[model samples]
Target: MPIYSSDSDNETMPRTKLFGRQRPIRSVLGGGQVADVLLWENKGVSAALSIGMTILWFLFEVAEYSFVTLFCHISITAMLVVFIWCTSAEIFNWTPPEMPTSILDKSTFHEFASTFHERFNQALSSFVDIACGKQPALFFAAIFCLYILSVIGNYFTFLNILYLCFVCLQTLPFLYNKYEDKVERYAGELTREVKKMFRRMNSNVLSKIPRGPVKEKKAR
Candidate 1:
């Protein structure tokens, strides 16, 4: 099996998948930069995110620090450092660090807002449909998931959940990218078993269920 890569930019090269994946792992991950970080191609960024999450988890989960308290402490420390740096720079006739407005301009904010708006609208539409019972199976699935999450929430703090999710996100993608051939074989077998069970259920159980008459829409 040819290992997938962001470097496989040639149009003639056929895209590979483990089972049902359409795009390259890099494309699924967004782009080369994101794939690089996740795949350990960029060790610096991966390490930074890992270390940052660990520290945050330690502070919030282990230390039991409130977000407000942490924010205040961070702000005070940052402001104090800036103040001291400015004062020292003035006394020693040295240049001080300055942030440019161009770092986060209107275009970037607009792009972010647009992306958020699209995703939020999509989620809102799905939520509305699920709540309205447009699809009974989907509605029940959502309910089941929410109930499970509620039960889990009772035991795990938000920070714990977030940290766990972060760890999984960091690890799973890399593992899948590396050992995708083996994973694909396992996934293929699992999928076949699941489909087989579903077929049996449909034939043995679901096929016996009574169906209501279809309501035909009247022409105005």
Candidate 2:
């Protein structure tokens, strides 16, 4: 009797080939490729539109009316708040649970508490740096200065423009710096926390598994 090798045994085994000497099926729909192309096109269009809008807003400011300027400022503030909230939500989703529990059993408070450490700290740090960094001795001094300047300049419509310019100048640097630094730091911390939690949970599960010769045999 001849010894059979694994490869020869496999070849000789009674089995039906799935597609016997036939050309592989070609994709008919091209769904994924089509979707990717569409997404790229959409992103390009969105970027173009954003650039156009920024230019238009600048032009609008130059030819500004008091009411329109105030409206734009309020709108920008609302947009910033919404943006921050959405970012915080994304961070929350990325973070892992410190304690193990079924998804269905999770409470809103527990979720918030677990996620708040990183997101809230980043937000607070950014807000403080932007609003309180320049004149730390008197917090909100920028706001106070703007208010005084607005009054001193006699509520002049053109002064609104000047005030807006000054506010942007003072705040933009802090915003850019904090946004670059703090948000990334918080994201890093959240990612590290998630990895640590997963490791701990894995260790806990592995520890609970029985260990010994019988256990090893059973595993096999």
Tens-place lDDT digits, model 2, residues 1-220: 3232344444454532222313211111122322222233345643554465455555556655456766788799988986777777688885432443554334544544545565577768866776756557456766787689778677455644654564553344335333644654555556556656666666677657896755445564
lDDT of 1 by residue, 1-220 (tens): 2233232343334434564578878666655455677777889879998999899889988898989999999999999998999999999999987856575467646754665576688789999999999999899999999999999999997778888898997998999988988887666656556756776777777878999999999999
Residue 71 in candidate 2, Cα distance off native in Å:
33
TM-score per prediction, in order, is 0.62, 0.19
User: What local lDDT does model 1 show for residue 204?
Assistant: 78
Model 2's alpha-carbon lDDT is 0.51
Q: Which ten residues in a row have the lowest lDDT in candidate 1?
A: 1-10
**Per-model root-mean-square deviation over C-alphas:** 9.4, 27.3
- Model 1 clash pairs are none
Error of 1 at 195 (Å): 1.8
